[model samples]
Target: MKGNSLSQVYYRPIEAAIRWAGLLRFQHEIVAAIIDSRHLAVTLNCPRCDELRLYIDRIYDAIYHGELPYGQNGITIDDKSLWDSPDLTIRHVDLKRWMLNHYSGQRPAFLFSRGERIAHPVITLEAGNALLVEREALKSQLEQCRSQLRALQEQRKKHDQAPPACTLCPLSDRAEATYLHIIGAMLTLMLGRSPSGTPYSSFNSQEAIASALIAHHGHLMGITERTLQAKFAQARRKLQSAVS
Candidate 1:
């Protein structure tokens, strides 16, 4: 019906904002919902059991990856041998009507929400590859963080102090290290080179100290800047005492 417009559905600005920011791309199908090519929506399929079973996951994968993810289930089109089956026609239909008739059985009068749909450029294969690369890089950094945490733990053990009981303390230190690693990896991904002269050792040192304090205290040391400053001050005094 004249290409269902989201603006026609009427939503408050705040509701629209929350829907846009909070919705995951993978929850809906990506479709060009406008007459002229300005807006897009995550289309929901109607409730025919076969359509529901076949197209639901297809839509989700398309929204998530910016392209249709291929699979080879008996019901799916990717089963090349079943390409000629009459049951596998890919039809693009009116999203609003589909939701009304199929999802709600025409019960909910308003099928389209103004802010529920968002327009994004389709992700190219290169972009998907780049994401995979970043994911691998994050995993590698996580491993490095684990190794660094182990080394720090060993170092702390060598000193004349009781061993820590709080496991989260070491995990928090590892998370901090991983956070830096993620930042570095992002920089490398965007700039096509590693960031120059960032002090990896010093970065780990800060995390090590933070972890040590948390291990001793059994909680996040503090939230306020002043409180953190006090903790650091205390740590410095303790270090001096140990040396003396």
Candidate 2:
């Protein structure tokens, strides 16, 4: 009845097969690049779907001839639930061997379809291992971003007591209020955390959290590293002035 129970027992094998086939490699690469500088040097590319479609066609053929148990009408093997379930480990192993034996090389185009040129993209053993490593790194970065966002929210709450009165009391009083609000907004954007627990807010989404971490640390957020360093220097100067 539990969600994870089904995943471990029934869906894991299929999921592993899909992963090994490199279906989710792009997301893995993005996450890995965010977490480690070394990963940034690694080039990640998605396997062409046309190639995967050919494998699916072969699977259908095996099922049709009773070489494999499931078929096109049975349990839809391509569903994410089946792919992610742990129960499929043995199935995945068997499937991997089957794939390697029959689909590992650039097969003749005529065998796949009449009068069509097709290349079955083969993944070298080394590339498969690297993809697994990159996926783990991405999972790590997601966890780290979640923790960092939590800490920033706590800090914001502690600092939310009251705004200090403006020193220039007579001239442009609203300007100081606007400045403080702008600074608060920037901090929230940088931290990607919401204190109000709103469901639809950008801070709650995976993409927002991922983007913020990538921007701040991954060197992919458009701003140059030099700009970030300069901002850090300016922040330190402002802090020192406040203390003095």
Candidate 3:
């Protein structure tokens, strides 16, 4: 999204927002319903939206850093990969139909009692910021701690005669190993079919592969697709560092 002196909001396609919802802590349907881009873009760009994105980013950090959080149910990622599967797509259609039937998107909301119009819903920025500041501060402190932990782990590995890579990194578990396998499977699929009618793997796009795996193995542990992706990326970086 592009931001200017007067405005920061832009009408990204609803799909873009939905995909973001899949990655972040928010519900896709609620994000789809409330994020009135036309309304937001024309008006003063919300400071609230900025806070929202930052909030999501903090949650993203927690998930990718292998931290488990409790409480804050409203804001937790809950470790579910919300990929754009067929079931989710249908819900999108259903929500659109219900919204269209209930109200007109082209027009503003009418308050018959007060006779006021809210073309786009407006929220007080200060109140939301007040609620978020304390949590945000705590999250910042937590991120600092994680960075220190990683640094200490690396330093310890340098002097020691290597107990194990997993001990040094402290970044992998059985579940994460499964996620890594999913990443490898995605790569195999990207390689495509072999010559002699021997079936190999299918589907491309790492995000899609992770999502599909989550769908099939919902019983299996998972976090955000982006988290799985982050894990895959971390593995690659470590491998590259070793090779170089």
Error of 1 at 76 (Å): 27
lDDT of 2 by residue, 1-244 (tens): 1121211222222233233344543434433332231122234344554443344445545534544433122233543333223232224334444545666553232122323323445467887797667656645655664566566545544444325454234536565444344433443444443233222233554345445645664633323455445444444455445446
lDDT of 3 by residue, 1-244 (tens): 3111111122122322323233223334334444332112223233345544543343334334444221121232334342211111112232233334443232222111123225344335675586467456545654564465355435534535455565567545865554445444334434344443322334445667568646754443333576667765765554445446
In model 2, where do residues sit more than 4 Å from their true spots?
Answer: 1-101, 104-119, 161-244
User: Clashing residue pairs, candidate 3?
Assistant: none
Worst 10 residues of 3 by lDDT: 2-11
Clashes of 1: 0
lDDT, model 1, position 99: 40
Better of 1 and 3 by TM-score: 1
The per-model lDDT (C-alpha) reads: 0.37, 0.41, 0.39
Q: Which stretches of model 1 miss by more than 4 angstroms?
A: 1-118, 161-244
Candidate order (TM-score): 1, 2, 3
Question: For model 1, how does the per-residue alpha-carbon lDDT over 39-98 read when each residue is reduced to its tens digit?
Answer: 233343323324333334433434244343222221224453323322222222223444
RMSD list, candidates in order: 18.2, 21.1, 26.5
**Native-referenced Cα lDDT, model 2:** 0.41
- lDDT (0-100) at residue 103 of candidate 3? 38
